[model samples]
Every structure is written in structure tokens, then in C-alpha cells.
Target: MLEVADIFRAHGPTWRRTVSLSLGQLKVMSAIEQCRSAALGGHVLRCSGCARTEIAYNSCRNRHCPKCQGSAARRWLEARQADLLPVGYYHVVFTLPAAISAIAWHNKTVIYGLLFDIAAQTLRTIAADPRHLGAQIGATLVLHTWGSALTHHPHVHGIVPGGGLSSGGERWIACRPGFFLPVRVLSRLFRRRFLEALTDAHRRGQLQFFGEHAALADRATFAQWLAPLRTCEWFVYAKRPFAGPQAVLAYLSRYTHRVAISNQRLLAFDERGVTFRWKDYRATGRTRYKTMTLQASEFMRRFLLHVLPAGFHRIRHYGLLANPVRRDNLAKVRDLLHVAPRFDPPSDDTVIQAQPVFICRHCGAPMIVIDIVARTAPIRAPPMSRGAT
Candidate 1:
């Protein structure tokens, strides 16, 4: 399969000299290019049962790398397994308009942070209204910066349980069957809160502008630019509630650690440019599935556009799911619903067998590390010790 790393390794050096990239983007390119290659370090493993040996290279483990997210997602989901409730779960998405996305390209940390905060606030506020569900809800929100076509589309996918704890925390309050909050209400509230927050950020000079958006540096010009967005509908929608707890986990695994594109989608890579499958969401039926080809440089540009600012978290929990009180909150919720806790403490007499990190492909036996290879070092046999006759 053609991978993003292939494109990066082939074109990255020349492309690096042609365009101006941020420190973060450059680091991502370098990491992806060297991943699982001799450029990075590796370990030689010997199978205990047979005489087979293999070299296992280290992964880049960058969150945005297409090849690295599977294990990362699995590990994350394992940690979250105990937090799942027995109730239905809903998938809600809050998307920023094109106007805001343009500015976000210039002020990622500030604007993206605002998007997370404001979306969480919108969901909690609506769910807590006496006229609505009348309870406080928890959500796990994951930020996705690119659309199917690798265009700069900023949005958050929220996984929310169908209900929440009541005001007194004594009982569970479930939303109407087959429904969460109204999409219209969520959209309106999200738009107002986001615009208000954006204005405040501008006042505090927390935002930046470049190229044509440089005019936004002026207070009046920025305010006027945001006027139309206030009246327009911001895309906020809730998909059907998941079938069950297992279904929710399946969905989360696919979305949580996804990158701009995956290697499985690549069809070809040649002088004609890189070809890949992309979904045209605007179309329906089989027509929605289409192939696209972009110059290798453009493909790299679009891929790197999603490298997040350092230390900025793309996944966040809010309300009852917030890290500080998640354990207590989940305990209270499981009790209210009369569902058994997902985890039980293991007894001292129980024996736990840990899975081996590496297994030999030639023989069905565990592999043991025999030697280590330094980064950028030649992969030749290690030198013999002084008395090894």
C-alpha cells in the first residue's frame, strides 16, 4: 500500500526548500519519513523455538501519522472501557464556518481552544436547562481539522451518553427515547457563544492574521467580518443513538485517532501525481466515492496542514467526563442506573499473564531482544567480544 510516509520521503526534501513551514510541520514530515525505517533505531529479535531472527524498527508514534494511530487508538479505548455507561450514546458534531476556519489557519492554538471550550459549554448549558433534559451531561470531544478531501475543515466530534445525573445527583435523567437535544438549539447556542468568545479573543489580541486576513487586526473590521456568521446557521447535528455500548466503542475507535488520510485509501503514486480515494460528501449514492489526484507537493502540504501546535490536545473531556472528577462521576452515574461497575478489583490470588511485545513470524514462539541498533547506524552484525573464540 502507498503510505503518506512514502510521499513525504520522496518529495519532502525538495518541498522543504520550496515552501515556508512551521517548526511543528517540519518535525511531522521528518518523523513520518523516517518511521519504521533504518533512519530510526531498531532491535534484533531471536525466536526461542526456532533460529529465526528479525529486525523491528521503531514507529514514529506521531499522532498525525497514518500508520501510528491504530495502536494509539486501541490503547486509549482500553483506558476508557471502564467509563462506558449502559445507556445509549449520541454522536454530535460542531463545525466552524469557512470564515472562522480561514482565521484559524493563522491562530490555531487560540481559535482551536475556543472551539473546544465553546462547544462543550453549549452542550452542557442546553442539557442542563430545566426545559430540556434538566441534568448535567458529560462528553468526550475529539477535534478533527480536515475534511474527507483533506480540505481545512475544523470540527469536533462529541460522544455523549443519552442522559445525565439530576441536579441533586440522586437520580438519572434520560433524554426522550431516540432523541438528544434539538440540533437547532445546539447550533444557535454554539454560534452565539463562539462568536462572543471570538470577539473577546480579538479584544485581548489573542488572535493573529496574515495575507488577506491582515485587515482583521482592526477591531471594526473583525467585528464586521463576524456579523454575517451570527445570523447564519452553524452546522451542528446529532446522529442516531448508538445501538449499544459495544457499538459506541467501535465508533470511537475509528474516529478518535484518525489522521487526515489513511494508507488504505491510496490507489497509486506516480509521475501523474498521487492518486487516492476521497468521499465527495455533497454527492449521494455510489457517486460519493471518488478518486482524486494531487501533485505530491500539494499532498504533503495538505497533510502537514493538520499537524497541531505543540502541547495542544485534540482530545478532551468535559463536564462529568472531565479528568479531575471522572472516576467519582462515573461511580455516581453507574449507581443511579443500577448497572454493575465495568471493572472489579482483581484478587491477590489471581495470576495475570502479560502479552509479549514481539512474537516471531517464522515460529509461533516469543521473540527475545538480542541486539539494539542505533539510529542512522548501519544494520550489520554486532562486533564480537574480546574472548569469544
Candidate 2:
């Protein structure tokens, strides 16, 4: 299968020399090139029963690398499985208008953080209103900055429970089984709050401007630029509730760890350029699936567009799932629902295994690691003390 790594490995050195990139993008490119290669080292595996030998390389394990997120998504889902509630789960998306998306391309750290904060605030505020859901809702917000075609589209996906605890925390208030907050309501309020926050950032000089957008550095010019967005309807979409809690987790897994593009989507690469499948969201039916080919440099540029700001978190929790007290809040909610509270396993209850889990392909016998190769050091024999075992 063709991969983002293949493209990077083939064209990265030339691309890096030609383009100006952030430290984060440089690091991501380097990591993808070296990932699972001999440069990063590996382990030599010996089948316990079949006496077969095989070598497996290590991963770069960088968050942005397309090849490195499967285990991460699995581990994250395992931990989140415990947080599932008996109630329905709704998927809501809050998206910025194109003008804002343009600004966000340059001011990622500031603008993206604002998106998450304001989007969360919008959900909580609306859900708490007596005329709306009238409860305190919880949401796991995942920030996706790229559209299917790698355009600069910034949006937050909110996985919200169909209902929330009453403000008093005494009883659960359930949303209608298939519905959560109204999309129009969420859109209107999200637009207002986000514009307001963005204006404040501009006033405080938190926003930066360059190239075609250098005029935005002026408060007056920026305010005028933001005027149309304030009046236009913002895009907020809420999907029907998931079939069950497990379905919700499955859905979350798809979006939470997604990179700009996945290896499975790439179709071909050659002198003609890189060909990949993408969904043209504007179209309907079978025509929606389309393949796009971009020059190697353009492809790399698009991929790097999503390198998150250093230390910025793409996933965040809000309301009842707030980090400081989420565990206690979840326990309290379980008690109300008459479900058993989830407790951490007792230290002695679980056994730790250090054995290699891979099986020998030829004989179907479990494989054991006999030699560990370090990337920066010469190969060494196993210690006599451990080998004696």
C-alpha cells in the first residue's frame, strides 16, 4: 500500500529545501521518514517453538505521523470506554466561516484554542437555558482543521450526551431520544461567541497578520473584515444519536486520532504526481467519491497545514467531564442511573506480562524477543544473567 511516508521519503529532502516550514512540520516530516526504519532500531524475534527468527522495527510514535496513531486510538478508546453513559450520545460540529478559517491558518494556536473554548461554552450555555435542554451537559470536543480535500476548514466535533444533570445535580434531564440541542440555536450562539472572542483577541493584539492579510493587524480593518461573519449564519451540525454507548465510542475513535490523510486512502504515486481518494462533500451520491492528484510539494504543504501548534491540545473535555473532577462526577452519575460505578482495578488483581505477543507466521508459534537493537549504539549480546533464565 502506498503511504504518506512513501511520498515523504521520496520527495521530502527536496521539498524541505524548497519550502519554509515550522519546526513542528520539519519534525513531523523527519519522523515519518525514519519511522519503522533501521535508523530507529528494532528487535530480533525468535519463535519459541518453531525456532524462526524475524526482525521488527520501532515506530517514531509521533502524534502527527499517519503510521503511528492506531495504538494511540486504541489505548484512548479503552480508557474512554469507562466514561460511557447509559444515555444517548449526539455528535455536533461547530465550524468557522471561510474568512475565519483563513485567519486561523496563520494564527492557529490562538484561533484554534478560541474555537474549542467558545464551542464548549456555546454547548454548555445553550443546554443550561430553561428554554433549551435546561441541564448541564458534558462534551468531548475534538478539533479537526482540515476538510476532506485538505482545505483550511476549522471545526470542533462535540460528542455530547443526549441530556445532562439538572443544574442542581439531583436528577438527569434527558434530551428527546433522537435529538439534542437545535442546530440553529447552536449555530447562532456559536457565531456570536466566537466573533466576540476573536474581536477581543484582535483588540489585545493576540492575533497576527501577514502576506495578504497584513491589513488585519489594524483593529479597524479587522473589525470590518469580521462584520459579514457576524451577520451570516454559521455552520453547526448535530447528527442523530448513536445507537448505543459502544457505537458512540466507535464513532469517536474515527475522528479523535485522524491525521490529515491516512495511508489507506492513497491510490498511486509516480512522476505524474500523487493520486489519492477524497470525498467531494459538495456533491451527492456516487459522484461524491473522487480522486485528486497533487504535485509532491503541494501534497506535503497540505499535509503540514495541520501540524498543530506546539503544546496545543486537539482533544478536550468540558462540563461534567471536566478533568479535575470528572471521575467523581462520573461516579455520581452512575449512582443516579443505578449502574455500578467503575473503579480502578486493584493492583494485585491484574497480572503484568512481558512476553512478546506476535506469532511466527510460518509455524503459528509465539515469538520471543532475543535481541533488542538500539538506534545509537552498537549491537550487544544479551546479559548472561538474563540469558540463563
Candidate 3:
């Protein structure tokens, strides 16, 4: 299968010389290019049953690398398993308009942070309204910076429970069956809050502009630029409640650690260009599934456009699910809902078993590391023993 790593390995050096890229983007390219290759390192393992030896290379483990996100997502989901509740869950998405997306390209950390905060605030504020659900809700928001076509479409996917604890925290208040919250209300509030926050960010000089948007650096020009976005509708979509808690887990396993594009989506990478499957969401039915070919350089460019600022988290929890009080909040919620706690601490008498780190492919048996392969480089003499003369 054609992988993003293949494209990066083939074209990254030339592309690096031709176009200017940020240190983060350059690091991402290098990581993807060298991932699982001899450039890193590997381990020699011997199967106990078959007595077969094999070499396994290490992964890059960069969050932006397409080949590395599966294990990352699985680890994240394992940590989040206890956070699930015994109620329906809703899938909501808050998308920034194209204009904002353009600006976000330059001010990713500021704007992306605002998107997460404002989206979570909108959901919580609406759910707490007396006329609405009138309860305090929790949400897990995952930031996705690219659309199916590899366009810079910034959005947050929010997974919210169908209900919340009452304002007084005495009882559970579930939303109407089959529906969680009104999309129209969420959209209006999201638009207003986001623009207001954007204006504040501008006032504080937290936003930046370049090229055609350079004029937006000025206060007056920036305010004028944001005027239309205040009135126009912002897209906020709310899907029907998930079938059950298990369904929500399935959804999270797919979306949480996804990179720009997966290796499975690549169709061909030949002289014509890099060909890949993409969904044209504007169309309906079978037409939506289509293939797109872009020059290798362009494909790498689009893929790197999503490399997040160093240390900026793409997945976050807010409100009741906030890290500070998640355990207590979950306990309270379970009591109010009369459901058993999903996670129970093991008693002292319970034995904990650790799984083997590596398994043999040829036989169903555990493999043990026989030797470590250092990264390719000049060989160094082994250190002398403690008693060496």
C-alpha cells in the first residue's frame, strides 16, 4: 500500500529545498520519512514456541504521522473508557467559516484554542439554560484541522452525553429522546461567542496576519473584517444521539487521533501524481466518493498544513469532565443516575498481569527481545566494566 511515508521519503528533500517551512513542519516531514526505517532503531526478537527470530523497527510516534496514530488513539481510548456514561451521546461539530479558517492558518494556537474554549462554553451554557436542559454538561472535544479533501477546514467534534446533572446536582436531567440540543440555538450562540472572543483576541494583540490579511492587524480594520461573520450563520451540526455508550467508543476510536489522511485512502502514486480517495461532501450519493490527484509536493504541503504548534493539545475535556474534577464529577453523576460506576479499582488481593510487548507473527506465542539495534551511525566502543583496569 502507498503510504504518506512513501511520498515524504521520495519528495520531502526536494520540497524542503524549494519551499520554506516552519521547524514543526520540517520535523513532521522528517519523522514521517524515517518512521519504521533503519534511520531510527529496532529490536531483534525470538519466538519461544517457533524459535524464529525477526526484527521489528520502532515507530516515529509523532502525533502528526499517519502511521503512528493507531496506537496513540488506542491508548487514549483506554484511558477514556471510564469516562463514558450509561446514557445516549450526541455528536456535535462546530466549524469556523472560510474567512476565519484563512486567518487561523497564521494564528493556529490562538484561534484553535479559542475554537475549543468557545465551543465547549456554547454547549455548556445552552444546556444550563432553564428553558433548555437546565443541567450542567460535560464534553470531550477533538480538534480536526483538515477536511476530507485536505483543505484547511478547522472544526471541533464534541461528544456530549444526552443529559447532565441538575443545576443543584441532585438528579440527572436527560434531554428529550432522540434529540440532545437544538442546532439553530447552538449555531447562533457559537457564532456570537466566537466573534466576540476573536474581537477580544484582536484587542489584546493575540492575533496575527500576513499577506492580504496584513491590514487586519489594525484594530479598526479587524473589527470591520469581523462584522459580516457576526450576522451570517455559523455552521453547527448536531447528529442524532448515538445508539449507546459502546457506539460512542467506536466513534472516538476513529476520530480522536486521526491524522490528515490515512494510508488506506491512498490509491496510487505514479508519474501522473499522487492519487487518493476523497469525499466531496457537497455532493450526495455515490458521487461523493471520488479520487483526487495532486503533485507530490502539493500533497505534502497540504498534509503539513495541519502540523499543530508544539505541545498544543488537539483533544480536550471540559465542564464536568475537566481533568481537575472528572473522577468526583463522574462519581456524583453515577449516583444521580443510579448506574454502577464503569471503572472499579482493583482490590489489593487482585493480581495484575502485564502483557508481552511483542508477539511473533509466524506463531501465536510471546516474543522476547534478543538484542537492541542502535540507530544507524558511527559505531562506538562499548563502555568498560566497572572493575576494568
> Cα-based RMSD of the predictions, in order?
6.4, 7.0, 6.1
Clashing residue pairs, backbone N/CA/C < 3 A, model 3: none
lDDT of 2 by residue, 107-192 (tens): 99989999999999999999999898899889999999998887778999989888888989998888886888888988888898
Q: List the residue pairs that clash in candidate 1.
A: none
Q: Candidates' TM-scores?
A: 0.95, 0.94, 0.95
Show where candidate 1 strays beyond 4 Å: 377-389
Worst 10 residues of 1 by lDDT: 377-386
Off by over 4 Å in 3: 377-389
Query: What is the number of backbone collisions in each predicted candidate, taken in the order shown?
Result: 0, 0, 0
What is the lDDT ranking, best to worst? 1, 3, 2
Better of 2 and 3 by TM-score: 3
**Descending-TM-score candidate ranking:** 3, 1, 2
Please give the TM-score that candidate 2 achieves against the real structure: 0.94
